[model samples]
Target: MLAFSKLTKSQASYLFSFGIVFIIYLISYIISPFTSNDTPFYTLIGRSILQDHVLPYKYIFDHKPFFSFVLYGVWDALMPIKTGMFTLLALCCAAGAATVASSIWKTNRFLVFFILITTGAAFKMLSGNTGVLQIFFQILVLYLLQYPSFLRIILSGVITAFAVNINYLTAECLSLPIIFLLYHNKKIIFNIFFFIFGVFSGLFILFSPYLYSDPLALIEYFQQQKQFLAAYSPSFTTRLFTVIKLFCYVLFFIPVLYVWVQQNIFQKQERIDPNSILLGLWFVSGLIASCISGYPFEYYYILWFFPITIMIAQIIKKPEKNFKWFFMPIAILTLFSVVDSTINNIIKYRNIHAIDYVKMASLTKGGSVLNIRALQTHFYMADLKNFDPYLFKEHIDIAFGSRAAAHYMHDLEQKPLSVLLPYQGCEIGAVEATVCHYLHENYQKIYEVKIVKLSGKIDHFSFELYKRKSGA
Candidate 1:
């Protein structure tokens, strides 16, 4: 029952911007051109939790921390609307980024609104990646660290611990906040000691479920997660290409780096702002984290959006004639890139009904359903149960190495009533020779629907469903 009249201009502006971003995201999800690979995987885990009351680590083989799934689970349990959940997560991210930018720039906070919503990271969040939600928590810590009180510093530590539970790699950001404490506070030792104390306290609270339920299982879970990550390390060459793609292809990096250079190298007379130093450190931390797994995933770069946008706002706040020429073209190119991506996404939307998930669901009823060489989305959309520990192809390949095909062959022996293949019939993973041969010989092709993607070109791909032959 609050009136807008009582609120300050800044507060009202934030509310209006938040509403606009949320509505835009909601509409974006409704007409989203493509679905990300990770969405279906996480949604399935959320479904399992709500319907079966079992954790992912216990029910299925998953390496991610439990917070995100729990968030999804709780939401689905209450409302069970996919688009609604996506809009909410996207809104959280926009709000967090806007708040962080506001803390840095007293005026022209709306400029960040445009920078954030137009970026590739924003689109990825709209496509339903839980990693976006983790960034929400990460930004909370970032904002809290800017002006440090003992309570605020301690709270930031607790939130940092919570963020790590969302995704352990965010642990790299731990140093940035601690460095803030050292820079800003006179009683560094006392503040840092309490910050560490708060972190441990957060961990204890978050992990209490595992501790009370089965401490050994929690230990084993981390061990398995560590091993899986270690085993899946990309080669040095691959990691180098990932870095190249991030810096060279993403145009937004230009302004962020330019501002840093302008401040540090060009304008040496003016004393550097402490806030700028922390933002720089955060940018470095995000870059290091993004490149850690050597994944060219668009969502990983989301970590950079907040700090980068804040840096972009600085150019608006204090214009320097020195690099005005360099900055102008870079800014225009970045905007064009973003606008092109958005139009392409909308243009790619196809009216063709790709997969008849309903018929597939009916055909696969009363028996197990397996999806091969298809996205896990096939399982979720059709409401089919995936009774395999290896939910993803990459995970299986990484976890089993040479034994991947053997594992697939073993799963085939279960004789799932219907096998869904998004690729052509008799086609599986590279090592899936035995799987292809077995499916061809024993399973009957009952239904298929062309998968017309947002690319606007039909590659002649279809989701083909197969049933085992009678007494095969």
Candidate 2:
């Protein structure tokens, strides 16, 4: 403890920020390494790129954009499959926390504490999606506020554009904020021209390799992405729940917004320009995108977590009146949400327990395995193949009637030797059940594995092993 005193305030704060982030990740992922479908899907995509020497459109599903698969390729090259992904995910979360902490240091020293807490809680909902890295990039856009130069402005555009490759929604959320900045600035054309140049160069640098590797696949990817978006139609209840979730986020910031108004408008103490309104618009755009996008996956919340947290932090540092009313209640709610989500995720994934991944590996030893919404990651971990490219629900939707489903069904024409029907429901509302029924008739179920909770409760799910029947 005496040795700790030797460090300066900034040094100590850095250590604290990193320690909090590290602990958050370590505890969250101790048992359940695979957090979401994204982890396996991306890993499988990376492996497909490595083995096939092409992008992963054939073996796995990916719709983000061109450069996303490129990063997965880099991920594949740098690390082993399962363990590597878990470690990388932890590192990304830590990096995001570190980025936010570092960004807050110059503005308000104490803000790092709130930033870490908020980011940790908010990020828990993601379960380590590309959102972690994307949030870090969004944080970089905030830091651009400090060194507002021609160079920095240009770099900001580049960074923002580059972030789109990570996830296209970021561009949707941030583009308006960039326009707002340019409009607010004294020089418009200068910033716009340089910003456009930087953005073009960055896009070229990021996207060129993907085009060179497989332009046709890249074109098909965008087409599929559009089709998926056009096809998505969530339930009215689902949309209502999503709006409520976004409102909860907005509610969490009520105190901060109140404080900002009191300080800037009522008190007239500070002139925190364009950025004051800038980050607000950025946050709003993200929420708008999340709401309107038809699919309301919770991780979409990660898009604006940085800007909103940073804005709240800035206001929290200097409030006109007692802000505990806001902080304490929101703090309690955020903490509860964090813990609750974390626990549910643990229980949800707990059934994916360590009870013989090798047994399933032996079942799918040689040929490509169709995951059937089961342990797709486990199959990838076993170094077996997922021959069917249609692993996602969207693909299942497209398969029912659309021509787009042909790409996915193309490989299935051969009827692979092994199949895994893991979920008990086997309920693909729109996906043609006849296709699955055909498999049942043609194949013989050789083995079964039940997925039961630690409390001795069966999840009503079983992982079945199937082998093809002899030649008819």
Best by TM-score: 1
Worst 10 residues of 2 by lDDT: 423-432
Expressed as tens digits, the lDDT of each residue in 263-291 for candidate 1 is 65467676776666767777777777777
Residues 1-472 of candidate 2 have per-residue lDDT tens digits of: 8989899999899779757754664465545556675666676676666667656465566566655666666666776544435545645654565555455443553454345444446655346567666766766765674456788887877887788877877777776777787767767788778878778878877667567877786677777777765555577888898888778766776776667656644555556555566666777777776776555566787666655566566665675467667676566666566666557656655556634667767877777765454555556545666666766534554544465334434544577877666544245332246556666677777767677766875453346667778882
lDDT of 1: 0.67
**lDDT of all predictions:** 0.67, 0.63
Relative to the true structure, candidate 1 reaches a TM of: 0.82
- For each candidate in turn, the TM-score is 0.82, 0.81
Model 1 / residue 145 / CA error / Å: 3.0
